[model samples]
Target: MANNQGRSVRQPTLLEVIIVLGLFLAIAFSFVSVVDLPIQLALFIALFLIVILGIRLGYTYNDLQEAIKSGISNGLEAVLILVAVGALIGSWIAGGIVPTIISFGLEIIHPSIFLLATLIICSLTSLATGTSWGTAGTAGIAMVAIGEGLGIPLPMVVGAVMSGAYFGDKLSPLSDSTVLTASMAKVNIIDHIKSMLYVSVPAFLISGAAFTIVGFTATGHVDMAGVESTINSLNSTFNIGWIMLIPAVVVIVLLAMRKPPVPTIAFGALLGVVWAGLFQGMDWIAALNTTYDGFVIETGEAFMDELLNQGGITSMLGSIVVILLGLGFGGLLNHIGALQVIVDSFKRFITNTGRLSISTVATGIMANIFGCAMYVSLILTPKIMEKNYDEMKVDRRVLSRNTEVGGTLTSGMVPWSDNGIFMVALFGVPTLQYLPYMWLSFAAIILVIIYGYTNKFIWYVDDEEEGQGHELDIASDQKA
Candidate 1:
């Protein structure tokens, strides 16, 4: 009921303010570095108060309550996905599957062909493991050592390595970013995956071609001997075989069967434990410890030592912390209406459905950069997307999948971003070196445009089924 003042009677209350602000601050403060903790925390806390003050001053109690609910409600499922992603990381590492992948990776690809191979290899491993960081930090490191020892230009190699890692990260259905993107957009993850190929495949193909051309033409020197030794060392350390492909295959089949991700990865992880103990001679007790704690090994070869060693749930802690900080900041921006204001500003430009699709892709790209994390990008995406969808009467999954296609996949090129950091560290190459290899991300962006404006693979809905995401709707989206 409207009050005498003509405002909605269900005004947002003050208590909701306390819950949101407290949650945001708690998450932000938990991740602040020890050295900068005091300053960052104080600023974050002050910002929270400022938001509440701004709302109380400008909005009705109802508006405030709704806005708070709008922001928090949007992210409710995201929190669960984040924790599941954490567990997935731990289980993958514990299973010895990650180490096994790295071992095989070093054996198959050559240092001369390394740049192109790095992109392909990392892409596959990240695809298999559904983890860009794990692929980058492990196989990526080995590639970097091979690059450094070979005298390949650091930036070129780093750029290529990062590009490959993130491509895998973006495309892998097992990835947290992929899963969360689907959830937030309210599309089935399979639909999200299918939609992603609209951009991702072309981008990866072009990137591979570019890197291959560069590899053939480059004058860079590399320590082939050191690379060989490292590869040999890794081969001896783990049971590297086609048999290791089982965990990855299981994930693919389960996802294809329309199973949820948490169980799929959990099952994949269990497969890993069995294989590690059975084939690699890794004791069951040690394998379990590695899953819960962390895992690393020594080969005694100078460069081959840390190069071939790493994984565990512990490896993802740093990434998780970084992710939380970005999410907390984004949540505050959303709470204060900055996010909505930004989204509204886009509406002024969209005169038609075609234009809105173009704009949606642009917004997705920008969100990935500004938010600096997939969780934030996914959360912030629908702020503008829903308005456009409602205005144009396009399917919500169209906007949702486009956001995933554009934002989550393109994070590889941002030099200061998490994917970039992992790639740089992994290859021991600076980001600038392999920028040419990053053409895959660019290609993906272009593909999103084609999908949207061209309506080529764009999924639409029947009048009755619109907005309510169902399995049939998802199947139709893909089929359509």
Candidate 2:
């Protein structure tokens, strides 16, 4: 009894596994159900402790400690990226990027074609901003109101925004999820994007076509007053100009240079502050305030103000908490050995590529059901597939593609997830209402699974390309 904590590491017990699963479920459910509460943080600290407990009970001291350190280290870049994104978003609005995007969105896209317009405009905006949340808060909201004015179904509008948001989110260099997925799978960013288009390309074409047909048939006018009033308010608050794009151009160039996202975004935000102070005529103090503290304005119409009155570092606190807690859940699993136990239990049964793909799909779905978070699904998949991937001699990117082809794209379909909750609140449409129209995301998943079984376009890395020179030693062993 005195030496139990000192005993060598052993297999994780079933109870330990349940604790890991339970932590993920609690954080996901609580965060979605109650966004105001920091249930994610609560779960993070609790899960962190649980891992330590699991280590004391079963894992060796060094193994337990090292896993925790490694897991946290894995998320360091993401944590930096998150903070930089928050600042960039805050200052971008202050610098007129968001307002400019919205003004253009309203100028050309009419309510008569609002749903299709929403999908198209938001896809472009998300690609520009590299952020789904930013597009949703800015242009997406404006599109919703326009869609509503046209008497379009809220479900269709939300589905359209989601489709576009996800499309850009999947490919944008600025996107944390995109960067994270590519890096974790050890795939080059360009390779990951190209590989994903195999499935995403068709899904995108079909989704866009469907929205277009529906828009052509749908008819009604938007509240021009509200749309115009909001743009006017934006124009008043910030000096909008084509020159406003300098900061954006600088950011894009930095990303193209393959600079890390954190520095690029941070420098972009700084450029935004300087632009606002000099070109936009905001005081230096005011520029800084808007950059860090969020800018609010009474656009006369409360509805318009609600749309524009957002941004700053503080706003992303909730997402940050959720992410840390999500990663904490992952850390706990790795610490306890329960994650490995679960994977091993599955890997023994997998015989070929077909079964492995099927299992991956199931893993993604189950992760969604349990965590109710798409990114969390990413964190869990590498655990399940790491060993089988090594055994099958498949490329890591193939495993990564399977993880995301479904997992990241399907979050909005879950009524209990954050994306679903946000959608429902944004448009007052229930998740069930938009489920049918979210064709692309669902279609993508199905196509991947069927294609996996049929072995169509399923490219695997040849032994020659498995250039794990230094990393191979530490890549996929059950022990490390």
Candidate 3:
């Protein structure tokens, strides 16, 4: 390609791509893991390096700037959702919704079954909200506190939380990631979800079983006194009641009705403000203040104080910064053709269905690692592999399913990625600490690779006329 100045522009060579990406990984890992600094700075430095690479590839500064803008635009929905979730969490706490849920949870959930229950509850919430972030910030937080009281390890609790959350995120039709993946692969959203069920359901069952086994065999003694005291603090601090749950209900109902997530969550936050005034005895000013700065209370109980002292728009600022930096870095890499070069390097190894499947999965994983965002991976991976799948006569849904299995599932494990930063910020658990416990993600990836080799659930274009056709017919019937 030639630039506007009539200068020839070329893709980065494999060696140059390797060097730039290797340097980026070294810098990011060194700064984030060893130096214990924030990931934003590392990403910024990486972005700067990519800009130099882009210029070296003969792209003008203007062309590179457009790529950065485009990358950031791709993730604007997530940024909006994060902002809304922050306000929603704060308002819900101020309105006593989360406290009520936690109070009820503590009373009913047994220590022997807490881990399994956490997974189930988070799955249901994420399925309903179509948002792992919202589920994590809300029910996941409550579960963490409950786990603390139950004497279960925090990492175990967060692991269960994330597994369940991502389960819904991967399969839910309402999820943005799900929709994006399906669109990019030219598959129907329903078809995309149905194809993923083969991998996701087994993974979910395995995760549930694992949590159950761990929950039952655990020797840690539950702190009944702590649980009771925490419950009491919740009751005294706010007007906890079933009615306070209305805000959450509204959000779920709106989402179920297929309302847009941003406005739905914002509306829920508004209702929370009203509830806080009516039931929590807070004036409108104080309740509204909580929406921006989060709810503040003096419960005199350290655990209660710590759990409740969160939320607010300001709280999401750090995450937003990380997301922006990550997206910018991804944009620069894409513009410089570094990502394309990396993907092309994997093309020669795709000699069979199994090789193709694993190669696609590996590409998705690498995209998330190098792109610093799941959106970047989801967008780029399918586009890169779409032609390969078509030429191989494979069903497009397989492409979408494998893309999500590789991209969405492992995104939270990359400590510098947007999902990873959000998980860490919300749960205060290091990514590495809870990573091993993400049973569903690990299971899904393994299952896809296994299925690819075994030819199980690997749909082909010819099979679609008889197999996927019937499935689509059934789906249409069910919709009717």
What RMSD does each model have against the real structure?
8.2, 6.4, 3.4
Per-residue lDDT for 1-480 in model 1, tens only? 453346534323345435554564454445333344532344345445545654544545455445544544444443333334344444444454555555555566555576788787678767777766555544565465556545567666666766777777766777777787777666677776766666677778888888888776673455556556655665667666777667766765665455665565556556666776787787888766655454556657665555434445555445444444444444445545444555566677887656777777677665654444455666677666866675566666677666765666555544333444334333434444555556766676677676556766555555455433322364543443
TM-score leader: 3
| Order of quality (TM-score) | 3, 2, 1
Off by over 4 Å in 3: 464-480
Better of 1 and 2 by lDDT: 2
Which regions of candidate 1 fall more than 4 Å away from where they truly are? 1-100, 112-201, 217-220, 235-259, 263-286, 350-358, 369-402, 411-437, 446-480
Q: Which one wins on lDDT?
A: 3
> What's the residue-level lDDT of 362 in candidate 2?
69
Candidate 1's displacement at residue 442, Å, is 2.1
**Against the unseen true structure, what C-alpha lDDT does each candidate score?**
0.58, 0.66, 0.84
**If both were scored by TM-score, which would come out higher, candidate 1 or candidate 2?**
2
Worst 10 residues of 2 by lDDT: 465-474
